[model samples]
Target: MKPIRIVCGTRESRQDFSTKTALGRSLLIHEAANPVDLMLFAENKQGLSSIYNRAIDEAKEDPAILVFVHDDVHLCDFSWSERLREAVETFDVIGLAGNTRRLAGQPAWAFVDDRFTWDEKRYLSGIVGHGSSFPCNVSNFGPVPQACKLLDGLFLAADSERLWEANVRFDEQFEFHFYDMDFCRSAELGGLSMGTWPLSVVHESGGAFGTPMWRESYRRYQAKYAEGGEPTPQETSVQKQTPVHQFHNPDLLKLMPTNAKRVVEIGCSSGALAREYKKLNPDVHYIGIEIDPSYAQLAREHCDRVLDMNIETVSAQLLAEDLAADCWVFGDVLEHLYDPWQLLQKIREASAPGSCVVACIPNAQHWSVQARLSVGDFRYEDSGLFDRTHIRWFTLVTMLELFTQAGLTVEAGVPRVFDEPQRERFLPAIHAMAAAAGRDPEMAVQDALPLQYVFRAVVS
Candidate 1:
């Protein structure tokens, strides 16, 4: 590891003067022993190309890790060098700040390297530039795993050698916006990994320009990424499909007939999904049965009818007589059951002939999860495929078999997209566990199984 180099890109405009002052104050307060260099470019100073050119030139003679900081950010941590060095060693790209909301024009911290491939997107951690440790812990911040994408240009560190080798410098095109995206895209293309660590730094939003200019910059960014040829059509398509709701399969609703007269949802916590079905097809009367009283109350609030009884203890005959549903929904509920097979049997006995059974289950065999487990990292949490409450895990084959054994047939099934950071984090580990259990990680990874499975079956 070499001495960390800090570069601040500033403009000569009046707006930039404040940013320069803030950076100057941060340097003096932190008393950084290493020589910190500052570069001020005009507001229209030929975009970020000039800044990168100067940085490359500075590092050309003596190569070192370059830590780029924006004017609005302040360095709270004195030992940022050490933590940044560690992150740079582990991840190809390291981001310093975390944002609660996704800022326009800024890249979201998504996608991390799992050795084999990148995992889900994530958020950076810490105060933007306040003097906290490089791996500083801030409240409400989660794991900034080395596999996530770099978010924001507030603060970041990267190896000079690797960056130059990949020719992945920030793109100066479009003046200001999309520089981060261009750089990240180039890094991904160049086979470099990216992530954020628990580095704390404070950042004042829109330091360089006022809100108006910031909005303009974001507009340009959106236009470039949206219309520009930089992000390939496939990349754009993938990005378009990257919304949060895209993770759930809308087709799962298709499992139920449009004119389904009666429907039952098992383990309907909150009845959110059941309510959605009811809204979509109002003609289909919906009934939700929940074991938890608290959640049952929530379901009752949202759903038409709620059964506040545990599926395991309830009598099949009584449940069947209570509401003869044409369809049964097991959306993300089976895995949490103490005995999924027993519940399935009960449902089978209760269901009418040709009644549709829809189920969703998370694949325990995603690739990223496999990589984590292969490296000996298995921490149990409250939820996910390895949720502490989960007594059973299922892959595609086993899930299908479970349904088939219960006298049901699969009609349509597809992997749902998993684009969220939290869910993506567990994927590698799940896949690893599945592989160790001699299961196919690829099939398990496919259909983005809701860390629980979603299945649609017909009761024979």
Candidate 2:
């Protein structure tokens, strides 16, 4: 039998769960017949979406088992590696603690006293710790392992491949608080089984429920699954018949490779480009990623598949693993990213080595921008390069570096030209700034150029 490969995912904190805590103590001494990878997310204003999405992407790199645990959790049992290996054999989803019966609008622990479950035999188990730990002061829901409708978030283990097959994940919208229950519901609805297992562990803090934000999240959760008090696969799906919008995307479309067999577009708003491309070659496969449910529903008219997922929180690896495209397109999309360079890295890592990226990125080096900044007038605009929504500002040099740093080589650069009249409108300010900064007027004009950049990229 192949050795079990595991990836332990966590939102890391100051506490040393990896080396100093109760779980860390057991991890240090356990010898298991398996390989494990650790993926820790830095909790710098990030949420569970980043961690869970990242973990799913890691599974693409290596088809392994996924074990998500809290940084505050300390596993105190020995031979944990071996025990986990044995326990996960029969369950698609396994947890250290879970509730057998989940009530509508009730939290996971609503039936804790009677619905508690632990281990394969449906026996009850638990432990407590200081600073709000349980069992020492509290108690296990009961003393038997039982099948459960929902599992606690603290210690969740699942086969990565099985999860991919089931097509369930930690919903990005849930972010931090309600993700555990949300995931449990998603898994159950997808026909995956949930079970509990024996483990000696200590959680440092009890949950904080009933906060204002918590209540808000709770309302959204309830609303999301309002169909018969539970959403069905068909009801929740976003693909539906939609009227085509008249959106055009010629700049990025022209850069597409001549023989492109498959194309995937990130930030594809209702598949405008896909619609046009399908008219040319109906046989070519096209896919899109749109965050808006309504937009994604309309995208089905143009794309073979539309994934309704936010680019900021979804993993590029996870998307690439499924699309396997000949070319990946990003039209006026990079500037909107939280970390464009990091996204570039993931794209390269996940896609086939020779696959290319075609992009249309705004030029911060445009003379109009320079002319405005020269007068100390950097004001947000409704749209264009200075669009208020643009989170990233990249000049020519930095824009070129995007491809290089992502381990991609630029095949060609195509400038999205602006008419001379536009440049002339800001020409006077350009010279004025040049004189103030003691630079040559011609050099200033040349330095501040390019309305936008459209490039064709391939893996280096």
Candidate 3:
């Protein structure tokens, strides 16, 4: 297949001209290094829409796919183009691109001017320029969806014929910003389909024009839209969706004793697992405790009983008296606590003797982690074993120690599935390490670093 043709447009700066020029040159060099075709254009302070239109016009005769990206953004994953192409074909949309904070609209102007506080959802509705790709189908002026009305400027693509026919030009009235929103709105009104896929590109928020341009744009929007009465912004509500566990560890679920009549799940987020337990043991009574009121409410709807209280603050005696549970679960909960062992001791005291304690703690010492640390990459973020909110970290040995100290005897211990690409990249090394550690070396790499360490222990 012919490689996609990517085009980028930027302006030369006198003060930072060398820096900006080097940046643009580096992008071209990187693109070539990836063996991808790239054509770049640098102009002096032209409207973004004008630059885009010129690039589109220049590439009109080329039979290859056209991809437009902002100069400020960096391509992290080299396979993004292929993934984006696949998504575009699957979704049948004109373009696919990355997520951005500033979208097209009036509220964004108010936000820029400090006239309004930031609402996480609406911040993007006002300024719409982003990275996007265009497919051949977009060559014909097509109807787009209402949801995409304000996001027109990011990375977008279209066929050569429709690009000229639709006269699909960004409104110069927007000058610096809002052109993307205007364009997307125009596309939607004219019947075109524009969408954003799960694939992403890294965008450095403010690399070009600084705060002055933002202030000016805010003034322009206020002048244009404020007089016409504020655009009735769309209201978006957080929807309650079912928790989909892609990593299935049935052995962890089996740890619950069949004869148990009562069960308690501490930190049951949305009560999904508790509901599963109820299904497994239909006659058993289940009670779940959650710190978040919203999740607790959802849990109540799914299970027989739910308590809206933080485990740390809730009196142990009160919880013990409320539900004399024979089985207690601490699934994926210990990592977030200040003192998991203390909580485990309380749970041990609260539950009946011989009650099963099913705990799922992510193994921090998994081989993949060791490799990442060996490379001097200790930076942590949300999710995974090193999730930012995790106040406590654990390894297989530490976790076993905690459970044993809590007066529990292990019945079963196994690793949970670790399927994330970054973590999976460490699997071969992990398998080798597991073998070196004199553990189950023959185990499949998929089983080497289970997403979590699931322990089924009986209270002794």
Candidate 4:
């Protein structure tokens, strides 16, 4: 048999590349049938996609497998090269950890909804390490070699010739985030299969989720691949989005019953939606809580009372002192909280009888997001569903689950539907994912198309 030509690329700061990790040690172990060509970008200035693409361009020899790795990851298993050689023969894509099953509206294979009792088998065996060389715990999905829909990007060995032939390209648009899954997804979409090679490796840091940069990166990924469903009215061009002062969803008003005499609004900036809502029914008393003092001051004209305070620090006393509301309006606030789940429970406990919590939350798993992810780009912006300020995210299922966990029951849900133009734009990507999920494309479209979940959550 011909020797496997393995080429490797790693991203590391010049200062931090001072020492080699387990990956370095494992690559040194040579097999007579396998020769390795390593490429370490001096200081990973260019993103992984660019670096990987650059390596592919610069390769003097035809490599069977192209390896991309993080400098921190330790390849403790000496048989890693042998494993890679074996895996590449059968599978086009290889990773250390992955999931066989992918739930709908999920951002990634690693991401799981806590509300839904999940199959903990998403782990396919890997390790996470602290400062020490020793691993803390073994993340196991099941004994490999396993087939999975997604793979952790910490260590990836991909079939070069196959991907080249398929014209599958690692999306350069994705910076650091969503590259691994995006690559694997692209390969799979091109009829490439992925499997886990039980190689011993450990990652240093658990990822930071929901940061502005991460959200931006995620947004870009979503924009490119996640399309379809009910696209939000907020999903529009940058020129239209700029110089915006306030945002209020009329859908929140629809969630409230006509009899609602008192309503409290969280994150109510200048009560933009309030003015629109009051125009329809001016009798309803509105209490506004806004983090921006300027906006809160402006809200006073439309509201019975307006308080300038961060919702993260909002207290029961604040809500109870002014008015016993008929319902609480969280128009688009839950995802921005440091602890939305806790706040939901607090809101549930503080409210009086017959009061409900009505919120308009962006679906993180919207067809648009899923579509972009399918292609691998997540770009964050100043405003819209993926506004940089949003610190949390939820799917329709997880949103309902949040209400349930907060001692509330879902009274009703009103989805913000996509216009025909938007629907036409996203349908193709949504159908593709639906087909991959083994569900009826039409039903999947119906189930996953809503841009936002506007719901009434009442105390159970």
Candidate 5:
């Protein structure tokens, strides 16, 4: 077996190596145990591609297996060198984690869309540990040692000869982001085989996702790989359809009364919230009301009862006689309703006195809406604040009025604000406008910040 040469870029210098860095410490420990076939190389004050390319070129003379890894990764498996050796026998290139398939506009290895939504677990492979310390919590994506189209660049290994022969090198144009993606695509185009391998590694950083710098890198990536082909009819139809209902609203779950016995959730999508909340209070009788029969069928596995009918059409007398719910949850459902005010009134009338109402509603006064409106771009999207299905909109003030008019006393409200960099100029402009309108500028800016509001209310 060829010797494994580990190549990584770090901000830390030689003198301050093992004490400050995760990779340095892991190397110090692993090298102590298995120093025979392992070699280490490091570069500081350079972009990742430059360092990796330099290492790849140098490996031509040495003719060793080159492993490119992030400086924040801690290699937990002592037998990793042997694993890499075995992996390269079958695959020319190997990674610790990867996706079996790649989408046209994939922003990341594990993600299928620009929304940063993860690809289905079925198409994913490999286990990864994450934390700031050594004993990390493992996230098992799926069974590994499988062939993959895209691999996570956090830890990648390949025989230097294979890369040199295939003429596959990290695209120097991509400094930090998309380099791995570019390299993987280039290798596949070059007819080099790729697969994921079982290796224990802990990555410290969660990544700078949604940051301005990351977004800029994504723009450059799209520009470089942008193709002229349009989506097929089937693909267009798939894209237009709403995503599967699997996400649980954390804010709604948090607002739920801890001791509530019976809970009725309006627009329960796949019983995700019920499934999650059931872990806390196992004996709670949960009922889900969903218009989609398929979603209701899925919800039946989690909830005590699943009502496959629209809330707007359900009679108040039937709701009061059957449900008698102590807690009612509406997670991002009110805005989609033709008349949420009437629905909430019916809920208040149907539920027990002092019964809790936990709801998550999108705020129309978010700066993104104002920013887009200024440019006459109020275009509806497949999802988000301007979802095409949304029939009504509400700001914080209007939302409060919504509950009050429904005879629900507002107990608490939590604003969900992302404080994105784009809001820097928009917020100040909003404050100025508020002042001109004789409203308190500080309070007005506060109202404009949150993209959504979560409220905990009770029947009065």
Candidate 6:
């Protein structure tokens, strides 16, 4: 059996390898257990594909299971080499974690679309550990040794002879991001079998996803692949699963005044928020304005009055009938309007002093949106920051401006954020961009963190 030849690249020099890096330290300890050939690129400035291609070319004659892995990963499994030896015999290309299907606009192996949406768990496979130590949190995607169309680039293994024979090589244009996806696509096209395997490895860094660099690489990937192809099976599946957006936001409810008796909600789909609020204030008269007659009918069960007409078409006199409402809630509704500024002015006319206007608006400055913008992917989704119905977008600054300009006194604004490990990794890139543009890194990070904002404004 051919021995496992490990190929990895690192920013750390050879002198600091064992002491400073996870891969270096792991190799030192594991080399004694299972001997293997190592090709380490220290202080590397070149792209990963360039580095891997060099290794592949160098090992053209020597038939061995070539493993291309990242420097931040620690080889934890004692029998990892033996596992790879067996895995290669079964599949032409092997990885630790991957998706069984691939979509047309997929930006990553695990994600189904450019929105960074994770493919369903059933279509996913493999489990990988994360963190600095051996006993780390495991992300169990699904069962391993399953057939996959795409594989994570963090740890990939293949026989050199097979790769050389198939004439499959990584595209050099992708310096960092999407290289794995591109490689898997190339391998699949070349008729090489790819699948995931059960391997124990702790990766320290969760990938930097929503960074400027990653987005630029994504554009290149899209240009190379999304040229001329019929809708894939994955794409068809995603299209069939159009997301439903009818959930109520608790943050918006919390922003409403407690002493208020009258409440009016805009675009109140099925009056979900009205139903929740009525539970708290039974005496509160809840009026819902819904364009859809079906939703208006459903909302009548929860709300005191349901207007089966568009708020845009409703006269100011009709709006003033519910005058002095304690709260006018627009939960994720303002952006859908053609003229939100005009509507705010009308709401101002209807409101009395101390009356609160609470709204939950999606932030256009969020890092995910920025990443999509960078890659030129403005494709609208059924629901999300990129909701197809959204006609306008706002940042925190502009949102405040909208309130203040419409004769409403801004009281407080709270951010709704969901922090992920990948999002945290994106901060360094944001900081670098901030420095280049002479902007405050702290403020830049602050602007990028929030997915949306819930603001409370009073008619002062």
lDDT string, candidate 4, 388-411, tens digits = 667788987789888888898898
CA displacement after TM-score superposition, residue 433 of candidate 5 (Å): 69
Please give the RMSD to the true structure for each candidate, in Å.
22.7, 16.1, 22.3, 23.6, 22.3, 24.3
Candidate 6 pairs with clashing backbones: none
- State the lDDT of candidate 5 residue by residue for 1-460, as single tens digits: 5677878777777666676778878888888665533333443767788889998888888888888988889888888777778899999999988987665567788886667888899989999899988567998988989888789999999999999987788878778888888888767645577899899889998877677777777776666554112322322222222345788878878899878898889878789999999999898989887766567668888887776545664556546755678998988888877678987898898787889899999999999898899889999888899887677999998999999999999999899988488898898888898999999999989898998999999987
Instruction: Give me the runs in candidate 3 sitting further than 4 Å from their true place.
Output: 1-249, 418-448
Local error of candidate 1 at 33, Å? 94
Q: Cα lDDT of model 6 overall?
A: 0.81
**Best-performing candidate as measured by TM-score:** 6
- Native-to-model Cα distance after best TM-score fit, residue 285 in candidate 2, in Å: 2.5
lDDT of 6 by residue, 1-460 (tens): 6768888888999788877888888888888787888888999999999999988898787777889999898888887788888898899999999987665667788875656778889989998889998568999999989988799999999999999877788889987888898899768645578999998888999999978999888877766543212334323432211132456788988888866788888878778888889878888978786655556667877887765444564446545653336788998889976678988888898777888899999999888887778779999888888887677999998999999889999898899988556777677777788889998988988899999999999888
- Best-to-worst TM-score order: 6, 5, 2, 4, 3, 1
Tens digits of lDDT, candidate 3, 1-460: 6456665566754344325543344444456445555555655576766666666676566644556566665455456666656645543234432122222233331232234554344323222223332211111112222123234344565443444544455556665565554555444323344555443344444323326775566555545422222331211221222232323346667776776787778767677776667677889878776655467667775566665444553346444664567888877777876677877777788777787788888877766667778789887665676666567878777898998888778888877664567765767777787788888765635444555788888877
Greater-lDDT candidate between 2 and 6:
6
Could you tell me the lDDT of residue 157 within candidate 3? 55
Report the lDDT of model 3 for residue 51. Answer: 63
lDDT of 3: 0.56
Off by over 4 Å in 1: 1-251, 419-453
What TM-score quantifies how close candidate 3 is to the native fold? 0.42
For model 1, give the RMSD to the true fold: 22.7
